[model samples]
Target chain A: MTMQNKLAWPKKITVCEVGPRDGLQNEKVLLTVEQKIELIERSVQAGAKIIEIGSFVHPKAVPQMADTDEVVKKMKRVDGVEYRALVMNLRGLERAEAVGIKKAKLTVSASPTHSLKNLNKTPEEAVRGFAECAKYAAAHGIELSGAISTAFGCCFEGRVPLEQVISVVKCFKEIGVSELSLSDTTGMANPQQVYEYSVKVREQFTDIDWVLHFHNTRGMGLSNVMAGMLAGIERYDSCFAGLGGCPFAPGASGNIATEDLVHMLSEMGIDTGYDLAEGIAIGRRVREFIGHDTDSSVLRAGRCSDIVIEQ
Target chain B: MTMQNKLAWPKKITVCEVGPRDGLQNEKVLLTVEQKIELIERSVQAGAKIIEIGSFVHPKAVPQMADTDEVVKKMKRVDGVEYRALVMNLRGLERAEAVGIKKAKLTVSASPTHSLKNLNKTPEEAVRGFAECAKYAAAHGIELSGAISTAFGCCFEGRVPLEQVISVVKCFKEIGVSELSLSDTTGMANPQQVYEYSVKVREQFTDIDWVLHFHNTRGMGLSNVMAGMLAGIERYDSCFAGLGGCPFAPGASGNIATEDLVHMLSEMGIDTGYDLAEGIAIGRRVREFIGHDTDSSVLRAGRCSDIVIEQ
Candidate 1:
């Protein structure tokens, strides 16, 4: 392949803040609806054009996200910001619609074993089950995206096959999902794998909006983002203070910190449209609310542009 | 530039383990000489060809490294592995000679503010002071390398100018020091800066050995390594368990973890001749000895190849 097509780096990236949904859902400390709304509002103020506000999963299954409906209802929606919710099945879709969620993400695991454990369905069964929710979302005029969890690798299955991921993407395409996200749920992706896989996916699925979600479980999150960006992918999911982990995966860590990602991208001359200092402030506030320290480095070390004045 | 020349990733990399010196020096809990010796032995066993044994700094300034001479004396010597020590002046160089250190690194700060605070001398004075030690090292048949700390950016001075760094490198070259290393003293390096600066250095100083040392304080350590590697720089300084920090630079995290770097490189199809499993084991042991967790993700999340077998 020629250099022009092979090494295309995006000039601007769209960062989707997933702190309120993906971040808080896995935390042991449950935030009230008001707290969740505040986080979403803070993220919007920090230049997050898209925010995953909450998920419509079973309340008992994920009690931390139990206040999803109330949070969406009470949150002051900004004119330009898009608030999205995640849904696993038809019932979750119905719940999202009940809250008047304009956008919803229908997610399934790419690994059969993970799908069985996380969603109580096989990979095929999970995608089949999403049919009803996809239809419901289309009928209600709700913007819907499909997410393939364990798209990079699974804790139980080791490496998920590329063919398997492609098959799932084909299914999502057949179901009329125009936007698709690939998640590194267990943080098992290497930069080379990310680059190669992204190249293939971008080639095959030319029409769909592709998003990359990475966990910093193995410290490859931002590196993978860099690789994906070099492969011409422009959208990524991040959390403030890096607050998120896979509850089902024992050793899983949090998503890439939003501030950390923004810091690196901004330094590389890539416009993220996000204020890193504001993101760090929000991260500090989240740490206080959660009563724990976070995995963010920019929050601790300050931005590279920060000057140190001698006392 | 052609893609082949512009992106010439090394097929093999030389990893210089700096845990025994850099990792332990800044730590609060002091390990016994035996523990330090054991860590060094384990690193050599895990295929570390070059190990920075210790620094010959004043005991009063860094009490944690007071037993450096004893630890170096007690450490087992492997035939193929090269052990090195750091020296700041002729006194420290004499101390290394007393221990019969075959190789020594004479280090000076690139930033004047950091040099004044760290060495009690300006940057120019620091380089001038190393002249006597460099001459002595050469006469004694000791292989000497010059390291420029704060080469990337400094906690006190912010961004150290590229011209300033080039001047220091030129001074080292004039002083007959053939090998040199650049350090991100406060972890302020971004990928673009690393790539751009490395390219400039590699072009200007074509014959000298160049090594990169990074701190993960801002979470850009490994990413910087990747950038440097892509720039055709093969040598790196890493600490087991990601130990080591700048005592003078507040909020600075540890050096990039040895196992983490090896793991990523191995997965990227680059051979480092180090066993990552043994590296992780050593990291865990170091953490236990220090009575704290390390900054390594591989130690917590396991290697990417690890499979979880649920009970």
Candidate 2:
């Protein structure tokens, strides 16, 4: 049966796993570099196409991600897979380049308040510095992607201007960053805002590969993903076992759980190229390894196909 | 801006709250009749147009609902609000009528295994008994609605036949019940199945007022709601603080939280007629009263508009 809707639904989509970088960073239980490597390898076995292994941030700022250099060096890399790392600036990119990393994402925040609090630089200042990283990346033969935090709304500032978000995209465009991930830093995006912004950004930047990253801080993460897909987006970023939360947004949930997102998309007949049962097992394992309860509904309640007939 | 999607969206829709009945019955904390009344009155004051105040099930079956009769008599009834209650059969319907309840819903399980375990009858036998309740309601001047639990799938039995659910609806039609609630008791429904089934049922039962009830057990509750909306169905059933889990499904979550649903809809410009801030406060209060954490995201992260600027 053909499905008709106001929006075009893609047959398949890319789900980028970022549990090691975005998820583990927020948890108090620090994982060994070996465990982080295990998580990344298992994600690849579960059919992950793009994986964000860790970040090259200041060790003092994010202690959980201090071992990024080791993780990038030791983790098993697959030939067809795109392993990504979050880099703060040119210095971080240099660190990644030293480790022979192929793909690094440059980060900025659209909310000026968030930019000041998290990066100690305004959003403008942050993107302006991306130019240097862009030049270095072009010379070094390394691929670079761009991510904008608080692209939809901000925790410190009530609402972020759409124009501010657009300006970051414009900078990324001029600096020749073709891949962009617009993230809901504090999970403040609603489906409508997401749909509108997705449509607006894609309309103007027609050649870019857009990835939507959302935090389930307020339970609208998957719904925002739905909105993004309806707006013709085909790539998303998620965490295993629902493992990430914004440090600034206290009591908020993490990124949309990879297991739950795969479950939903698969049922909708949209392929994510991930084995769900394998993913569920990994989600449960991560929660157990973390020695705490996670926010994963799939791990708690098994997939729809798991049926038990009682006497 | 005009919104266009594959489905037609209603400018406003009714959000039927079942927290008082469906939510409280699953909780270990037994609230006094006075507290139940307070919850009901507060819901009415918070712009709830339709609410399931309590149930008429046997005390042995659901001890938490044993005080339902007392709740029905003691609660302050507001004008223009449709206060609803659950009933097992004619006997339960008689009890609701004695207290002058204007509306009562008779339920049957679409899953035969669920029917045998929960109601001690098959799905076919369950609906046959509803005929008596329908006759009694018509003669007594009370309105009757039909609800098919486990309509989508069952914890005991994996996938329920779409035809079986339709047969129950046909039985309701023959008995003159026009408003029906099709509930995913096990939260085993996917968005595609929900959309296809919703469209099919509406196509066949042209005059029926369809209300979609979903559980957040597997985290697809709101996504299923989106599917139904995309299928042109309006009314939805939700619980406050995301309370209520099926006893049969071990480790499952409860219904989709009312506050979260309202938050999503209001942001999309679809009016649910509820005040979000007040709803969030009530959700937090429910968790406090029950002395446990709930599944409400808005309570934990606040609304999109609730911003706190850090120094």
Candidate 3:
């Protein structure tokens, strides 16, 4: 596609598949560390460059992801692919750092209530926790990516003021954090909110790369993604088949489905170096593995061109 | 809520729920007429004014919607609700008319191969058939709404020429179609195509209402809906729980899920006069009634705010 073609439309955007970590954590079936590694390998083969391998949360709290270290250790490190792991606190950061994990994400809830319930800390404490985690990552030569959960809105608190998100971003940036992700932890984000929030973040911090983490809990995941894309933010986190929801976060759903996101981007003629059908197929396999139907519509319904006209 | 709030954004964006018609027809387990009627009643209650309740297709061909007459007969007629039935030809139109359907939608495929396989007629023959259906509807004091399926692009034919869609729109207008719906029958539409196509149709038929029928096959359904909405086309079709697809249309899924569409519109503070939570609940009820899950993500995961956070 030429520049005019690119400008005449939204480019086919690259997708970051977060299914292995974000998707599996919410499942009732606890896949073995081998299964998690296999899932990551399949996702990479399916053309996922950035994959969330696992979270370094307490095994006691999230038994499903108990083998995060083993899974990450055994992961086949592709030449160009980036491996990501989620860390919630200083201890999790230490666990990731100990595993030689080079890149990890730190999440803090914007809503004080969610922070308390989910992390056993307040928003301020969570920010402090990130500050600590970022410091630890820096000392250990790991890249720290901070995500403000409930940046768009919160389930417990209802509406999280944009000021709170800005403050969180400001605090994170003050500690030399250059990569940030805005999360709709409860999926309360509308397109306008996404646009306004994204624009606000971009205006405040021009140097940082901001990724959007949206949930389809209320069915606005793709719309929010579009709004974020239109607002000039590119990186987004999606799960295959729109699966995975936090068992702790009430009403939280799987992130936007990777296949659905890729489908949209591919249709826009943006090159993601990914296969749409393969993405859907992998999503279905994951769905079968989990033994539950996923929320992704595209996985079951193939692309428009897949229509078979019977005579 | 208020006129100021409603007009604060775009006003009167038409959302036609095609769940009863488009959504149910694609399911393996066919719903009874009573269940279909109940779904339609809830749809109208949820502020769907234009409901595509059923189609007049052959029973053997689409056994899922075999009881179109019974469904149409039992549907509660609201004062402003414009109920529509899909008609593929003169025979379908006669059946729709016999059932007292005041508004009948006639479809002609833009892709020749699809038209031949789907309707066993050439494009010219399908157009002529719609023209005759229009005349018949007019004589019977019913309105004819003409739709061109695969207008954006076809699965078999690949890229559908822009002129082909425009020509069909012109023919429908010339035949005095008060309304026209351009369908991405196989989900071959992207935001750019949606934008370009709607602009083209608007320029050609300034007097006719252009309704868009999109499938979320590639996950661009809502984006295309927004693009069309921005292009000044208000009326569009959706399915409850995003249910519906042409069994013959191969990879096509249901139209935009009604709850998700309404959720997007309502959250923008646009007045859809619909309750998002209620729509999802209705979708759930229908899922149980049909004994299968619908493709709507919102139904499985309620709104983020709807989550009950136990203290």
Highest lDDT, which number?
2
The local lDDT score (0 to 100) that residue A274 gets in candidate 3 is: 83
Expressed as tens digits, the lDDT of each residue in B1-311 for candidate 3 is 11111111357577788888777777777787788888888888888888888899898988887899888777778888989898777888888888888888877888888778877877657777667777788899888887788888876778788887776666677678868888987777887678777877777667888899887766678878777765778887888877765454444456778877887787676677776777887778877877875556567566555564655
Model 3, residue A270: what's the lDDT? Answer: 69
Better of 2 and 3 by TM-score: 2
Best by TM-score: 2
lDDT of 1 at A297: 80
True contacts kept of each: 0.51, 0.60, 0.47
Better of 2 and 3 by DockQ: 2
- Rank by lDDT, highest first: 2, 1, 3
Per-residue accuracy of model 3 over A196-249 as CA lDDT, tens digit each: 788777877889988898887766788788778767777889998787665544
Among all windows of ten consecutive residues in candidate 2 chain B, which has the lowest summed lDDT?
B1-10
Clashing pairs in 2: A5-B6, A6-B5, A6-B6, A244-A254
lDDT of 2 by residue, A1-311 (tens): 43443234688989999998889988898899999998999999998999999999899998998999999899888889998999988889999999988899988889887888876888878888788999999999889989998898886786687899998888888889999999998788877788888888888788999999998888888878887888889999999999887665576789999999998888678999899999998898898779987888888888877755655
Instruction: Assess candidate 3 and give its lDDT.
Output: 0.77
lDDT (Cα) of model 1: 0.85
DockQ of each: 0.42, 0.53, 0.36
lDDT value, residue B264 of candidate 3 = 78
